[model samples]
Target: MSYLVLARKYRPRRFEDMVGQEVVTGVLRGAIEDDRVGHAYLFAGPRGTGKTTTARILAKALNCVKGPTPDPCGECERCLASDEGAEFDVIEIDAASNTSVNDVRELRESVGYAPVDSRYKVYIVDEVHMLSRAAFNALLKTLEEPPSHVKFLFATTELHKVPDTILSRCQVMRLSPIREEQIAGRLATVFDAEGVTAADGVAAELARRARGGMRDALSLADQLLALAGNSPQLADLARLSGGAGLQELLGLVDALGAGDRAAALDAVAAWAGREGELAGALLDVVRSIVVAGVCGAGSPHLEGGPAAGEALLARAKALGRGRLELMLADLIRARERMRHLAGSERVVLESALLELCTLEATMSLAELEARLASLEARLGGASVAGHTAGPASGGQLPVSIQPTPPPVGASATRSVQQPTGPATGPATAPGAAPRSPDTPQPAPGPAAAPALEPWKALVGALDARHRTLADLLRRSGKLQGSGSMARILVSKASADEQALLADKRSRRACERALSGAMGREITVEFVVGDAATPPPPKVEQDPFTRQVADLFDGHIEEP
Candidate 1:
């Protein structure tokens, strides 16, 4: 006795027996019952998606002894013969081999003859697009106007290759790939019929591996039952699919979420040879994490089922949504990179996994903003304090702001609420609080104005003018006073910057910017700050500067 594969043994016997193609089957059933059946019908879809099976069902329905009923009597001699492809009138041709004009000419010649013992002389041609142009042309007339007792059925995986002339005469039915849920549902029924005891998620995983093909799903199920002897588990299915088991994959994701780089690298090393499959498995889990985050833990879309979703929810919360999204994007790009590579697939996959592992230490955008604000507050208060502590001996205090460029066209306004006013006022005698508003007010003393917040905005505003005089002033000098601003170009210049700033044109340029902002005729003065004052603290905190300095084995030559 020959062993029958599940794909053949469970082939759809009728229109209603098919899976995941309700729309097409419903139309076909209605057409048959309403006596609106077309002379030539074309079925198009992916391989193993019930294209030929549909054609045979329709043929059996038309040629049955019951005379063109949608529900054919399978026991009839004509129906049985048609099922076996041995009927005298129901002809089945494989266009892949018989694609010549002579074949079509023979078919055309035979169309004039009557059926042996059926309602219509049926012709089912599989992969009809493989026919030569000449063969299609030879059959065009016969196909368009076949005899009343003749009918034609054509099936093709590539509908685009079928010429429009042949297509215009035939009715087209497009079959869609079955969904994983639908495939798994069908597999459950098959498992019961076969008396197989498969674990939960095993059939679901097999259906997923089928990539939307029911026949492929059935074939994989048969192979799995044969290999594992009817008691297959998720691990067995994972091994068959050339990827890690769900638990192993979950562990890798956990390592990544916890920022355990070595653990993640070790896992990557363990799956070195199957990097592509490992990448796919990792992507699946990451996708589940995203789905769990957005669609909730109990959503049915989770690929690993509820157990995997529960496990993934913990990691999803640990890594947060943004980092998980970035990690998912990285995995997608890594898979694309390894698509055509002949070797070195492990490097790309490992790098992506390591990056995801490091995602735990990375700060979210909101967190980074909070840290920057805190630092800005501390640094701003410190700088304002240092400036307020003036020399008081006819000498001025230096207020240096940290140089950070506001991106182009951005608002550089920063409202620093602090009394950075000049310390030139005589200290009011201690405990002297009796001066009421009604009392005669003491005349204000004369002193230089303090560097205001708008000055920093002016400097930061010139980010578009990088590596120029504007950049030099932002990096070194400080703008003080209001309308008659003092443009103190410091001694930190590299000789060329000094020449550029000391130039009259540069002074006028600064005065114009300051004047327009201050709404008055601004006079600029260039002077280096006295050595008694110090530069702003933490001004050299830009890591890029430090990296470039290290790379060049040099320091920022500030005087």
Candidate 2:
């Protein structure tokens, strides 16, 4: 075939030509320029991050006829052959297929030979980690110290698989994943070179789809060119890439933000059916929302177009920070689970979306805490404006604050103060008024009244917040005692409610509600019967008495 793919046609011919790998190329260039090139070199990173390509470029630089220069003259006979991958001196081997001790022995024997034409005999091994232990051991000595005319270039995606012994013998270079901007800039250059007309955003979209791999971006660009011919638009790129369109992704987010479970599920189902990586696309949108929430505005920092980003930002704000975080976490988990799940990706993805849509139903602790904070703020605002008084009125103080009573059974008695100003609490209800300080004090006899007051206030507070839970507590029992020791008499209707409240989370929530209402920490216990009254004891009867009872069909009664 006469046609060359973009990946090969645009392959970096010189160290300076490599993209998004300045460090690796700079080091190699300096090594060649200073004539300090090592006998063995290892390049490692993710796939399509220029490991093998850099190795090839390094090989060419060393073998060029114009001495060991970083810049190889493309017109030179040796450089031309090396670029063509046909040079007799620069041999490229796929270690994946040639992973044997015998192969290493053959390679070792060839390393000692002088170059047929080039200055240096370069051996490039791709996927070097695939070689077996025996193969590695066989080549260790040769790699550690090779002939003056010979050079070894090794490339691997998994650096950890390379033995430390092998690693110690070579100059290792770590390459990082290419950034999106770098990939997009490279794509734009390719587009211009090919005489293809594309929007600026088109290249960026393709770059994002590449997921930090330059080769992937170029390959995708090639596909887009073929599909759209000479003039490719952003829509064409999205269609060819099998990615969820901006509108579709935005619709999904809107559905979730609106709590429309069915719509969200439908969106997932459609996206899953059409796109290869539905969950990943959804995760991207969700992650963008989380970022936008943090930024507190709709910034066009995400992969999509401006309008889509704005819409997403608006939805993110409407959904609030807590819901966005939960949604983000759910999407991430679903994507991970999809990897291990077979033939059920759509089901899992839809289920995850639906779950996120109904996040309000399953309130997380973080959400509850945020709600409580808002409630506290409102209450605090109300408390500050509760009372005001003038000094001219009989020299009475304007502000009166009520101090909570001390624990029951304490020797000291604390009096409740009446504010001369308006009251703000529930105690200031229509008929209820604060007692005057001069009024005769009521004697405290039973501890039940004080103990029950807090519990009643707690029930009312719970009712205002969570009605169902408050109802459950109302049926649970009546308060029986005071102070550090108080009890609730459990009835038959509250058995199930009590069991449910026994959960650690539920119990803690109840305790928090009680503490907030009472303004102090108090211990509560559940009792089955009356705490003050004792049950009757049973007496055993003699055998004759039992026989007499049996004859009359009567049972003995306990006293």
Candidate 3:
């Protein structure tokens, strides 16, 4: 086996050869030049961010026969051996394989020896986090105060696992994840060196797939080279990665935006066995959509090609910020749930996507508030759809969902009562509509003409927004009330409609709709009864009552 993989072949030999680690490499170079080098250094960061490589480079620099210069003469026998991690004096210890007290004792015993031939005996410990507690305790004395001739260099992906005493002895240098641009640039250089032709975007795509690890990027590139031979493309990268393609994810987003659940599910079926990947990729697309909604395309920066980013922006604008955020949250939650939930990951992911696609046109919180304000203003002068709700005196139905005091003589249902207060609310003009129930007001005077059909107006208003809910409510109950309170008398038989409104999210949407129709803040209480409002049965609750109780976190009681 004469072939060397690109990761080993291109390992950085000198500090300058490292990529995306200038802060760390710069500090080490400065330390070497100023001779302020510490006895022990702990390199901490994610794997493949050059922890071991940087430590090795530091060893080579210190042991170089060129008078301890930062730039080692690669031609020197010691420097060459250090580069290959074969230098007898510069020992490389993999703590993972030697995580025992005996191993540390052996290391401690050897630390007293003088450098075989190099200027200093460098002990490079990789994955030092894997050392057992006993091993760590045994090595503490040596790590704290090694001989003046010895240098200790440690590297770990999990810095927290290293004990504090051990940490205090070492000058810990935190290495950050490599940036995508730097990784891509490194990949391009490697490809150029290997005489391989690749698509313009192939390097960048591979870099992104690395997720901030130079070694990972190179490893992915090696796979790409093996599959495509000498001329790799983005398609090869996508297939080899086992992740959902951008276009497929985009199609899923498009279907979600269009409220096409089947289409969205169909679009994601290609990655059924790879639900984690599909969900993760969809999360990225939704995040981009959210970013595009907040800012323009490539506002902060761009990751993919221009066309893809612009398309994301267009889809974001079409989907609107509210829906994009909801979808983003859903995707994130689904991805997290996939980690713990049993059965097929596809089931968890697809259910979430389906739920998102079912979302009706939603407005941002700001927009919802603004629309409510505008509706109140409109109520001051005109009836909604030319109709106003009659006082509770009329034979109309009762409809209430807001959290207000229980109706007079009503004790079966639990309600969060507003503390009683004076009529601080401004007096309603001879014929003005109320603005809010924040302050309870006197019931409106009896209508001169038969109370105009306000329920009609309410249904009509909601029809434009939540057609399904509004239609169900129209058949299941009727809105009736005035001043500070409104009630919907729901027929006990309309269980389907009752269940729909009982949903936590659906209830909120319905409330928003009702608020607009009423022109003021509405305290809606749904009375699940007809003419003879009987007391609730407390002994044996029905499924509908149980569900409502669960949704509201309340219980039923007899009057």
Regarding TM-score, does 1 or 2 come out ahead?
2
Q: In model 1, which runs have C-alpha deviations exceeding 4 angstroms? A: 96-113, 129-139, 160-167, 241-290, 311-364, 370-559
Model 1 Cα lDDT, one tens digit per residue, 1-559: 8988999888987888999999989999999999999999999998878998998899899888885888988899988987776888888999999999999999999999998788888898999999999999998979867899988999999999999999889899999988878889999999999889899888888776666689988988887888887878876775564445667777888777654655766876777677887888788778878888888878887665777678778777766777788788878987997886647576656556645543323344465445444434533653444445432222343444332122121121111111222333245321121112232222222213334443543443332222265556755665434223333434355423433443444455455445444545555645433233233225322322222323233222221
Instruction: Give a tens-digit lDDT track for model 3, residues 504-539.
Output: 444455445555555555444454443233444563
Number of the top-ranking candidate, with TM-score as the measure: 3
Q: How much is 152 displaced in model 3, in angstroms?
A: 2.9
How are the candidates ranked when ordered by lDDT, highest leading?
A: 3, 1, 2
Candidate 3 clash total?
Answer: 13
**TM-score ranking from best to worst?**
3, 2, 1
**TM-scores, one per candidate:** 0.55, 0.60, 0.66
Question: What are the lDDT scores of the predictions, listed in order?
Answer: 0.66, 0.64, 0.68
Each model's Cα RMSD: 16.8, 17.0, 9.7
Error of 2 at 183 (Å): 1.8
- The whole-model C-alpha lDDT of candidate 3 against the native structure comes to 0.68
Predict model 1's lDDT versus the native.
Answer: 0.66
